[model samples]
Target: MSATTDGSRVRNLWDEAKAATLDEPGKLLYRSNLLGSDKRITNYGGGNTSAKVTHRDPLTGEDVTVLWVKGSGGDVGTIKLDGFATLYMDKLNRLRDIYRGPAHEDEMVGYLPHCTFNLNPRAASIDTPLHAYLPYPHVDHMHPDAVIAIAATRNGREITRRVYGEEIGWLEWRRPGFELGLELARFAAENPEAKGVVLGSHGLFTWGRTAEECYATTLAIINRAIEWFEGELKDKPAFGGEVVAALPRERRREIAARLMPEIRARIGRDEAKIGHFDDSDAVLQFVGSAALRPLAALGTSCPDHFLRTKIRPLVLDFDPANGDVEALVAGLDGAVEAYRQDYAAYYQRSKHPDSPAMRDPNAVIYLVPGVGMISFAKDKGTARVSAEFYVNAINVMRGASGVDDYLGLPEQEAFDIEYWLLEEAKLQRLPKPKPLAGRVALVTGGAGGIGQAIAARLMAEGACVVLADIDANALDATKADFAKGFGADQVRGTRMNVTSEAEVAASFAEAVVEYGGLDILVSNAGIASAAPVEDTTLEVWDRNISILATGYFLVSREAFRLFRRQKLGGSMIFISSKNGLAASAGASAYCTAKAAEIHLARCLALEGAEAGIRVNTVNPDAVLRGSKIWSGEWREQRAASSKIGTEELEAHYRNRSLLKRSVFPEDIAEAVYFFASDLSAKSTGNIVNVDAGNAISFTR
Candidate 1:
């Protein structure tokens, strides 16, 4: 919901999508994200949506049947498949021709299993063809609150006419189905270069072939409208006590968490994961108070909002200890019904035979008695988006037309988007797995070559990593080097003993306190001890287990606890040696501890999976020459025993596997990075052999 912005002119969603078409998956993902974001603005699911797809013809010996749509019961905010209907592009293109709204659509095939619709509501989102007809590979559309607010004013139509020229077309609100989409297509095609559009008394529309362009254009128009209004309206003095600026990102969420439950309680449901979301202070402050000037209906900016934001946020008068769920629900429902009826009357006024009529309000917005205007999304992300859209909507309406002269889509026209098939498709989809963006991570023993390599890799692909180790000097030195190479404050360091509970506890506390949350843990700390079983002392055995095995348990246990509490899930990795599984004569406790560590990793994997955590191990053999435990003399001896020069010995060790090269700590680090990242999202309870291909003891 929060996007960092700089001063730049905007392009349209249509253009952005077109440029990004080559990244077919990215195009689909970005467009869907855009649409999902749009839905958030005014609770558009069941309102508006977008999609970017690759279409080919199987009949003509080509690929076809690419679709992403919002589903029947889908919300723009949390839309997934079942939210969208997939059909051959040819079929959708054909449907676009006969879409004469209620008249022609009433006779068309009703909802099919592939339609992604519930039995009661069989309407394809009206904007389906609107997206399908896009010349660009990607498409985006939104029922902006600003446009709608301006459109809904007393002099809405006149104000819109004055603010925007035909560079953006204005349409009379009409019934949605095939008809509205056709009209939109015709308008778009006519003004190929037009960057903006306004639907009289309805909403606003912007497009681009690529995500960046589309997002930019949408923001540009909305922002411009807002600026215009602010300049024209002239402030009415700061009322003595000046209004304060908004809070920072973290503080905003903190405040929202405290207020969310109270808002949810008013809506009447107690079981849900709505907490995993974001919110807007501007929206909260604006809508929370009924005392604010009530201008017009910004509830369902367009029907698409319903899918994402659930019609609109309830307007409740909340207090400190209020548990009156019934009153709250009633108030919310009553407000929503009022909105629905208002829409119904508007529909009646704007209806024609080609129009498709909807039965109720897709979404509703409540002017709460005191708290603020809450933009509701089906989920947290959507809600946050809806609030943003609302903010833009206010800006557009006020900017384009004076506060009292807003314009919007007519009821019938709004209906078409509310029931758009293509728009729904945008909602009912999944992102093509970016894996770990915006996620913070930590790598234990990260100062060494292996840890450094893994940390660097993760950072390269966009992940924040905290390099931790017990060696204070090494930790600081590593941090300095890493920070230099990456950026200021890029790699952080903490020195703590893996074997010490107090130290481990202290480290974890510091991590959680500093990073807010941790998503990855690479347990790569261990000590090597060479002793025949006959001469292995209990003290040595205990030390090995303590550092190699028990330490693993301690580190893993706390990470597991943190994962559970944070509920975001995480990944844990253990670095075991090939000796753990194969017989190595001189090492008894080392092998045993490592072997036990592997099993420990497996068991941990099983338990953590429930909480979305993953556990895996890497067996690295002969890759320890430069490790703290291995000295230059040790390396020389190992190389000599191989009957080759040191470099050749290293190459032999590396080449021992399928590839003939020495496996350095970096090689092991790569494996660790994979498991710690999304590449191994589904890979848990498994062991990766990082020793090239040394067949020490063929388990299978």
Candidate 2:
């Protein structure tokens, strides 16, 4: 087996030289990482690997077999040594003595901690019994798309026999639990020559006497399925063939930009949502296919895929050939309402007496013909991951439908797994959401110190930020730094010249597509020029006014348009200077533009009141520290006018202030954060002076 595999085979990434230096548990971690490195083998957090190692008891001083498996809610690819749960095999096997059949199997999960070895704190997953009872020293269980594709077909058992002969067996679908583990042990004991078994409508399980052999066996089994599907689906029309040709790429994006906010507004009524758009070839093919509606209605087959994507997706009534987007928009209210009703009905029919309450009824995945797919969730990462899971479902549908009749899990069974008590407990244990959890903001002049600080403050409270700046290099660096601190999904960068009407419009459009829609706008892009009235040229005057006054106007206008479209209300914060209120010498153009920004914000506040769009301003004076505006001729001119050396400018400004303190960019950012958050909900058309007690610059 080669180290890397294309679509035709599974890559053999195990390094004997590397494995030789590690102990048994270390080798298990190595095997798990290697298997998870390929999505073709398993989706994120969808699989588990195990090794049974001999450890001397801390108290008894005698060697005993301990089963080490991936812990609850852990991802195999990124798991660490501490990510595994260790249990004594004898105690795990003893669990069968108290097992009271499938109805009481859930209670078994409560007893797993008692079986812990060496006082490991990591919680064992529900699949612990499956790995514990297996007769092999090493075991692998994965939800590979190709294997699940075979397992999801009506004729899956016969197909399994034909493809793998007697080397691999097949078992009908049973939710993972203690009873399933006994069944697996029974099968292994009965068929001593079998290498693995395909769990119908679920995934694959393989084992070996050694870690290396187990890793190789898992790859070979998945590769065989992949090879079989390649031959079987060779000439078959996928998803009953595409019925609609994909719209042009740019046209598709335009449609998504228009539709996402409308959909987001409706679905996000209970909790705000972030959106992800996927126009990948796989998504386009599935959404544009003749079988799209019926197959989607049947829902996903694998539990892993179904959980993230919801039971099924909502198929939009769109036709690419006609290009009737307005008609589609007109029908959105009805379409969205219908999906909600259908989902409620599903929950009503499937709910057990003790089942957890139904979750958000709106579908997670949205299918649009001629375009692609859109997924929404509480945050960007979940939305993106949900879309990726649907693509996996799409691939499963293609392979199963092409070779045999594709079969989705029974509705009741899916509901049991979805609302399982254990799953509910895990959800309850998640940390509370941050203050601005689902909010999205756009910050202009985002590469500047004030802008960066403001963005960081918003993101710290869980807001997704789009850093828009004309300086491409600065924007990239700031975006990277923010992404490293927050996650990559929480921040995006776009090149935007705030003064250009087109650029402002494009930037807002990008925000809508990137993260559903905007909730806040920070107009901070600016320039400072210092010259006596006689020396101030037209070029210098225009430069100051264009970026300070007109730039603020352009971005605010675009934000208002988006805010109205979303109908979710909004917040806008303008970064004005203290000169807007207090006169400053030799800076006629700069002072005039700064004053204009404050007035413009006041005007917008009045106009946007009915729509719940609050506009406010933050004024700062002599904020010399880390400010790009204070780095150039403006500093020298101000120093000269104050009759102080350039190097003494900070002291000069501090001594002039009533409180004798210097203002910094962080002070301005805090004022902006207050206005951007709900803390200032009832205080619109307000001005906050962050000038460290500059009495002349006070808002009063």
Find the candidate with the highest TM-score and give its number.
2
> Which segments of candidate 2 are over 4 A away from where they belong?
1-4
- Candidate 2 deviates by what RMSD? 1.7
Q: How accurate is candidate 2 locally (lDDT)?
A: 0.92
Cα lDDT tens digits, model 2, 499-564, are 899999888888888998999999999889988999999999999999999999999999998899
lDDT of 1 by residue, 1-700 (tens): 3223233222234454454454554444444554455432334443445555555544576766454545444555455444555555666666645545665563444422333312323245445655656555445455555556565566655666666654566766654455556677787778888775666555666777655666666666765654445555676221111233334445444433334333333331222122223234445444433323332343334443333343334444434134343465445445555655765665576555645544334332433322334443233344455554455554443443445643444444454555454443444554542345445567777777677777887776555567778888888988888778776333567787889998887777655433345668888876777666898899989999999988888889888876775556788888888877887776778889989998999899889888899999988877755576555554565555555776666556665676565678778878887898767889999998887677774445
Residue 659's lDDT in candidate 2: 84
* Estimated TM-score for each candidate: 0.48, 0.98
Q: Quote model 2's TM-score.
A: 0.98
TM-score of 1: 0.48
Write out the backbone clash pairs for model 2.
none
C-alpha RMSD of candidate 1 = 12.2
